[model samples]
Target: MPSGLPSALYGWPGLCCIPLKRKNTDRCPASLASLIINHHEDSKAPQLALVASILGLAASLDWKAASNLNPFEKCMEDPDYEQLLKVVTLGLNRTLQPQKVIIVGAGIAGLTAAKVLSDAGHKVTILEADNRVGGRIFTFRDGKTGWIGELGAMRMPSSHRILHKLCRSLGLNLTQFMQYDENTWTEVNEVKLRNYVVEKMPEKLGYDLSHRERGHSPEDIYQMALNKAVKDLRTLGCKKAMKKFNRHTLLEYLLGEGNLTRPAVQLLGDVMSKEGFFYLSFAEALRAHSCLSDRLRYSRIVGGWDLLPRALLSSLSGPVLLNAPVVAITQGIHDVRVHISTSLQSRSLKVLTGDLVLVTASGPALQRITFSPPLTRRRQEALRALHYVAASKVFLSFRRPFWLEEHIEGGHSNTDRPARLIFYPAPDEGALLLASYTWSDAAAPFAGLSTDQALRVALKDVAALHGPVVFRLWDGTGVVKRWAEDPHSQGGFVVQPPSLGHGDEDYDWSFPYGRIYFAGEHTAHPHGWVETAVKSALRAAVKINKHWSRVPSPEKQAILHRLEHIHVSEDVQQQEESPEGHVFVEAIPQVQEHITVETITPGKGHVHVHHQNIPSHVHEKVFPDVHGHVHEKVFPEVHGHVHEKVFPEVHGHVHEKVFPEGHGHRHMHEKVFPEGHGHGHVHETVIPEGHGPLHPGGHRQMEPGSQRHRHMHSSCKGGGGT
Candidate 1:
C-alpha cells in the first residue's frame, strides 16, 4: 500500500476513515481508487475500494466520533473483515445518498462546507451576502504599484494546520510576512521607544519588560501560567479542577497568588486590553495561549490573502451566489427552505430548498434573519450571549519602503497609542504597511473614522514612534477596514465572557439544529483564526452527512447523544430542566434481535420502533451494517404519525436517555423480549436544534423569483475599500 500510493498518502490515514477533516487531508479513495489499484495490484480490489469509498462518503465529521465509535461496535459477527474485504478489499466504506445542501455565506467556513459536501457528491449551492468570497481574508492591491496589503486577516501561521492543507490543495506559495522584521517602535501615552530586537526588549508599550519582568517574556510568562492552570483541564478527569478557574475573569486569574509584579501587570494589562480582558474567562484565554506558545511561523499568502479565497472558490464544484442574502429560513420535517434576496437592493426573494442547510454567517447576521420557527430559546440565547469583538485594520501602501531607509524591513511597533500595532510588509521598495491594527477600545476611535482621518491619525502616531523621516516620501492613499461597521458580518468574530465555562467548547453549537447547522470560526474552539473557521465547517458538513445516511448502530447513537449533550453550559443545563424542555416518548416495548434503531443526528427527538408489520409500499432504503444485518430505510422528516415497523419482540426494559428538550425519548430495548409478542405504542418523534418546543409557523411565502433555486452568480463585490 505504501509503495503504490503517493508519498503524502499517510498524512491522513486514520482520519480519512472518519467523516470529520483532521489535521492531515489526503485524497479520497473514490477519486484515487482507479489510479491506485489495477490488475497489477488486484482485479477485484477496485470494486471493493468503490464500496469502501461509499462508507467514506457517508462517514464525515464530529470531534467526538473517535471516542464512541470503536471500530463500529468493536467485534463483528458476520461477513467478517476478511470476507467483506473481498468486495472493497482495500477499504471499509458505507454508502451515502447525497443530499442537497444550502450554505449561507461564502466565507472560509461556508466555502469549505460547500467543497467537502460537493466532493462527497452532494448537491451544494452557496449564498453570500457580500458579492465576493473569503469573509475576512480581505486584501487591497495597488493597480499602479502592484503592491498588496491586507485589509482583513493578515499572515498565516505554520501552526494553522487546516489553512496549510487548503494552501497545499491550492498549490499556493507562502513567503515571510515581515510583520516583525525590524521590531519597529512603540508610542504609548507620551513615551516613544524602538523595537530593538536585542537580547532584551525594553519597549514600554506592549512587549517591553522592566527589570522585575526581565526573566519572563510576555509569551513565555503567559504560556507558563496557562499551562500550569490548564494542565488538568485538557484531561478527562478535570471536571472538578475546571470549576476553580471557571468563575474568575482573566485579570483576577492573572493577579492570583501574585503571578506578576506591579509593572509586569500594567505591561500585560496594556497588551491584553486591546482585546476584552474584563469579560474574557481565564480558562478560555488560557486555551488561546496554548496555540501562541507553540513555535509560530508568521507568514502570508505570497500574492495576497484574497488570492487564497479566490483559489478556494475556483476549487468548488458549484456556483456561489454573490449579493444573495437569505432573508428567512424555514425548516420543515422534510427539508429546509431558505428565502434569499436576489440582490441587496432588490426586495425580490428566491426560495432554495436543501435536504440540509448550513448557516456560516456571523451570529448577528443570523439573528437578523427570521427563523420561520423562531430558534428555540436555547439557540437564541446562545446567539445573543455570544458577543462579537470590534476591530479595525488600517493599511497604507507606499511607493518605496521608507522603513528601509532606517534599515527596517518588517515587524510591528507596539503602542498603547490610538495607532496601536503598525506592521511592515515585505522588504520590497514598494510595499504596504498595516498602520494600525487595533481592537476593543483601542480600535473604537479609528474604526468609525473616514479613511483619510484614520491614515492621518495613524501616520501622526507612526511619525511620533519612528520620527517623520520614515514618512517623508509617502503615498497619500490608505485603506481602513472596521469589521464592526460591516453590514454583512454585523460585527467582528465571537468572544467569550467570564461567564463562559471551560467545557463550553464541547457545547453542541455545531450540531444541526433541525436541518440547519451553523459554522464559522465562532462555532469552533479557536474562535478567532481562519483555521478554526474551516475546521468548524468540516464538522458541520460531517454532522450533516451522518444525518443524511443514518444507520442503526449503538456506537453512532451514543456518539450522537454526546453531540446532543454538548450543551453543558449552566444556563442551558437549567433550561433543560425547565418546563419548555420537557419531553416524553414511548415506542416498541421489546427487542428480540437487533431491532434497527435508525439514527438522525442526536437532538431533542423522539423515536418509535414497531416490531409489527410495516407496509412495503412505504419505500424504505436499507443500509448494510458491519455485520450481515441491514438497517431499515430512514426519512428526513418524521411528522405527525410515523409507522415505524421493525422485527417482532416482546416485554423488555425501557431504554433511558436524557435530552435537553422536554426529555425526548429514544427507546433502545435490549434483546430481552420473546419473538412474535411485540407491543405497540402511540408516540411523536420530533427533533429541534436545541432542547425546546417545535413551533409550526407560516409558509415560506416565496416571492416571484422563488422558482429559481440557485443563487444568481454575478461579479464578486464587497463594501468599497479605501
Candidate 2:
C-alpha cells in the first residue's frame, strides 16, 4: 500500500479488490464489495482517494463529516475564474503580426497587461504618469523604526483567486490579514462595548430600535436590508434588477425596503463605519457588500502589497517610461498615436504609435488628456461624472505595541469619531497603527486639513476609542493619507450613483473608443480592488491578442485552441426576459430528465429548478404549479446563436427568452492611488476588481461602494466577463 493511503482502508470490515498502480497488485478490505474494481493505471490516485473517502464515510456513517466531499461544492465553481486562471497560467498564443502595444499607466493593471502581451511576443511599452509604480498598492516603511503603513490597498480576500495566482506566480508570501476579531472594541455615541456583546448594543447604547432590529448587529441588519431590497433580483435578471435596485440610495434602501427604523439605520451606519457612505447608491453598496461579505477571509502580502507590483515590474520584458504622462491620443485608420509630455520646462513631447493602446489611467486622469476626434458623448460623460469616493487614513507610530495589552490583535476598531475605523497592525508588522481611516463624507473633513491637523483630530478619536494611555505610549509621530488630495488619483474608490445614467453619468466606461482601450479597476465591475486591476489587465491583453491571425504555429494554435473552448463555455450570459412574455435561460447540465419541476396554485407557484454550470446560459423557470403533478418540460437543444423556446406544461403560458450576443443587457465600470513615503499624508486609491457577484441583477459593471482602507472588498474575487 502507498504511504499516502488512508489508514481506515487497511482496517475495513469486508475484503475486496482494490484499484492499484500499474505495477502493484493489492487486495484492499472495504465494505462496498460490489463497488470494488481493479484499475491498472498510474493516474488512479484520485479515484482511489475518492473510493477511500466513500468507504470511510460508509463505515463511520458520518455523512456530515464527509460533506466536503459532496459534489454540490461544484456550485461554487466559476467557469470564468477557471478560464481566466488558465490564461494566466497558460498564456495566449503568440501573435502573428506582433504589433506594437502602448500601455498608459504602470499600475498593477497596466503591468499585468504589459506582461501578458509581452509574453505573447508583442512589442510593448508602458508610459507611467507618476515617477513610481504600484498605483494603489502603496506601502510606506519608516526608515528608522522599519514600521510599515499601508496607505492604499493593504489586504485582499482569499477568494480573490486571480490575485492569489498572480502573487503566487510572483513568489510573494501572503499572510493572514485579521479583518475581524471578537475581542475588538466598538465605540459609538460614547458607548463602548466588545464585539461579542454586539447583539446587546442597541439596549446598551439606548437606541430605540424596532423589535426585529433589536437583537441584530449592524452587519446583520445590512444583510437583511440587502436581501429585502434585492430579494427577487436574481430571478428577475440583470437589466430589470439594475433598474429596480439602482433607483435608491443606501439610506433609502434601508428605510424603505429594509423596513428598519431611522434609529436602527443610523446605528448600522455608525457601527459599520459607513455613515459617510449613507447617501451612496444602494446598487453600489450591494456591489461592495458582495465582496466584503463575512463569507470570505482576508490576507495581506508579506513585506508589503507593493511587492506584487514590483515583482510584476521585474517580470515584464517591455520598457516602462517613468514620469511620462500621455497628453494626447489621436486615432487614425491604421493605428493610434499617443503624445507623451517628457519635460515640463522644455515643452518637449515624445510620440509613440501603437497598433493598440491600453489606457489604465484613472477616470480623472483621463479627463486631462486630449483626444483627437473626441471620445463618444457617453464615454466622456462617464469619465467626467464617475463618482470616486473620498478616502483618508491617519497612521500613528507608537514606541511599543500597547494594544496587545488589551488583547487587541490584528482586527479593526470602529467608532463614530473623526476616525471612523482604526486598524491595529499585526504583532510582526512593527509598532505602526492605522489610527484613523475614513471614507466618503467621513474623509472629506480630513482631506482639507493639514497633516498635523488631521493627526491631532485622529489622536483625539484614538484616545476616545482606547484611553488617555494612548498619549503616553505614542512616539509623537504620525502619518496621514488623503485620496482626494492626490493629483494622480482625484478620489479613493468609485461609488456608482443611484441612477447609472440619465444625465452626465453614463455606465459604459469600459468600452473601447476606436483603437484606444481602457484597462483599469475603473473599467472593471465592482471596481477599486487590486484583483480587478489584474482582471482588467487580463481582459485588455485578451482583446489585444484577439487582433492577431487565427492561423498560427502548432504550439501557438494549441493555446488559441484552448481559448476557443473557454470562449464557447464562458460566452453564455444572462439577460432580461423579452419585451413580450419570453424568459430566456440556459439549460441545466447534469439534469438528464427534467431540469425543473413546479407546483402552481391559482396565483402562487413553487419551482424546484437546477442551474447549469455552462457559462452561456443560466438556470431559470417560469413557475411550478399548485397541485402535486410534476409538469415535465422538454427543453429544445440550444446551440450557438439559436433561439429555441423551452415549452414546459405549467399552469400559465411559459415565457422564456434568450438574447443572442450584443442584444439585451450591458454595463460599465477606480483606483485608490497611494502617495509619497512622507508623513505629509500619502493618499492612495484602490479600485475593486473581478467579475460581478451573484445577484438577481446579474453582472454589475458599477464600482464597489465604501471599503475599509486596509482591508479589501469581497467583490474582488475572480469571475469572467467584462
TM-score of each: 0.63, 0.66
* Worst 10-residue lDDT window, candidate 2: 665-674
- Per-candidate RMSD vs. true structure? 19.6, 24.9
Worst lDDT run of 10 residues, candidate 1, spans 656-665
- Cα lDDT tens digits, model 1, 1-722, are 22444221222112333321111222232223234334325667766576455545434433234323222111111222233222212221232665668789988889777777766667677777785678888888878888877778776654455676667667788775543432456555566655432113433344445454564334334433443453444453344444555567777766674365455566655543324544476655644543332123356788788877777677665546666677677554345667654433332334455666789988878876766444666667677877788878887766667777766666667777787777776566266778888765567888657789988888887777667764775678878889898887756676676655434543568656666788887777656788778777776766666556564445433444443221111111122333434222211121111111222121111112222221212233222223333233332122122233221112322222110011112222221111222222111223455422122321111112111111112211222211
Error of 1 at 7 (Å): 38
Residues 341-371 of candidate 2 have per-residue lDDT tens digits of 5443432334455666888888888888765
Tell me model 1's lDDT, rounded to 2 decimals.
Answer: 0.53
Clashes per model (N, Cα, C within 3 A) = 26, 38
